[model samples]
Target: MNAPAPPPAPRPAKPLFPEEPAERHTLSVTVDNEAGVLGRIVGLFSARGYNIESLTVADVSPDHAVSRITIVTTGPRRVIDQIHAQLERLVPVHSVTDLTEAGPHVERELALVKVAGTGEKRVEALRLADIFRARPVDTTTSSFIFEVSGSTSKVDQFIALMREVGLVEVARTGVAAMARGKDPA
Candidate 1:
């Protein structure tokens, strides 16, 4: 009465991949500030089908030979690792560090937000801006351009509230990130 080994115990169902969920990451890459170096780095992302949420680059050295690029993107953890490895292999890229994972870091983005409203809506907008510590960089009778600098989430929250009031347009300086300690990225 073996009973066919009880049908060999039912197997659990599982997805073919079950890949890790994608998450936002900020990557800081130090590279040689030369012609076509940025293009090559961007090409790598395009070739691999990755998307860049925001990108900013500026020379960091007095000699103008070194530059730092802050790239914001979202991808699975494994894909992020791949990006780091590939970036390091680039000829001009000196180093690639994941600021989101590297101990503690500071990230900030500046946004110029325009809101157009009148009466109570206008007053409400001003009140909200004050609470957010936003400065009115430009002001006219009909509208005000607020200059806000803070973490990404803070800027997003402010923009969302403005939409409910009278959000006109926004100019943002993508994320700028750096490691907190003395160690260089």
Candidate 2:
């Protein structure tokens, strides 16, 4: 019978990076289309030292009373939860969605890549663009502007390849993501 079975051995604390590698998530926030509101949202991230890989904002309402912001970031599950909680607390925010956890979603970005070259370089660039399904939006004898829309990784790969060919400038539309199926977010 036990000399009062000495208190069971204390449990050890759990390790931080437990199993899975950190995951990247996309968040869509709906907020009032008022001045400084964007700043506040960004400030929240900055103040907390969180990194935003991509951010895109647009007024979606016809009345211009509401704006939608899509943000992409990477972190642990717990950290992502914290970000959602904080975003919900913002006064101007009407809704916050963690697309990664909110079921199926579709994410895409548009990029305008400019490359400058001549002869074989230019021809090769066009060939590569065609392979990537990128369309030439502008063209001159010495340069071309290609418009491409796809996943972030696709855009990144295209840009990297373009750099090797002769990347001059690049403008990306960040990321625009939305939940799939009948549900709306």
Candidate 3:
């Protein structure tokens, strides 16, 4: 007697990573300021093996119950769209905007660079900082703290240049971005 064929093995779940062209995008997410919400958002990115280039979060509303998160990542355009869609579906996320795809967006980052040097090296550091328009937030005989705000690429370039002079420490505030025009996201 021919036994009834067992049901075909269930297909494996599809991978979260999609096959698509690599592209850079900035996403602005509005979410409830509740415990574990940030963890869930980050977990979604990590579980899928996606890379986050920069991430920043802050409470923007007067009520302090809502937070805005800005995340920069690189992936295929299709993948980015899928990520946005998935993020939108999250329970805590109130809105998700792909600032890269959104028209006329502005992004900025702030970095505090510390250079420790003596004599000529210190002089050169100051000279270079002046060229970059980095203000001296603090100063000592052997070190200078420079505060610079600009695009990520600009901050990277500044850091690279400072390395040659005597970069001792660095702290960066990840990307903060918003769409242009009167419309609020």
Q: For model 2, name the residue pairs that clash.
A: none
Relative to the unseen true structure, what is the Cα RMSD of model 1? 5.0
| TM-score, cand. 1 vs. native | 0.88
Candidate 1, residue 106: CA error in Å?
1.1
- Give residue 66's lDDT in candidate 3 (0 to 100): 97
Per-residue C-alpha lDDT of model 3 across residues 93-172, encoded as one tens digit per residue: 99999988887889999999999999898999999899889999999999999999999999999999999989998999
Across 1-185, the per-residue lDDT of candidate 1 in tens digits comes to 65655467778998433678888899999999999999998999999878798999999999999999999989888888888899999999998999998879999999999999898988999999999999999888879999999999999999999998899999999999999988876
- Model 2: residue 70 alpha-carbon error in angstroms: 0.2
Clashing pairs in 3: none
For each candidate in turn, give its C-alpha RMSD to the true structure in angstroms: 5.0, 4.3, 3.8
Q: Write down the worst ten-residue block by lDDT for model 1.
A: 1-10
Q: The CA-based lDDT of model 1 is what?
A: 0.92
Give per-residue lDDT, candidate 3, residue 96. 97
What TM-score goes with each of the models?
A: 0.88, 0.88, 0.88
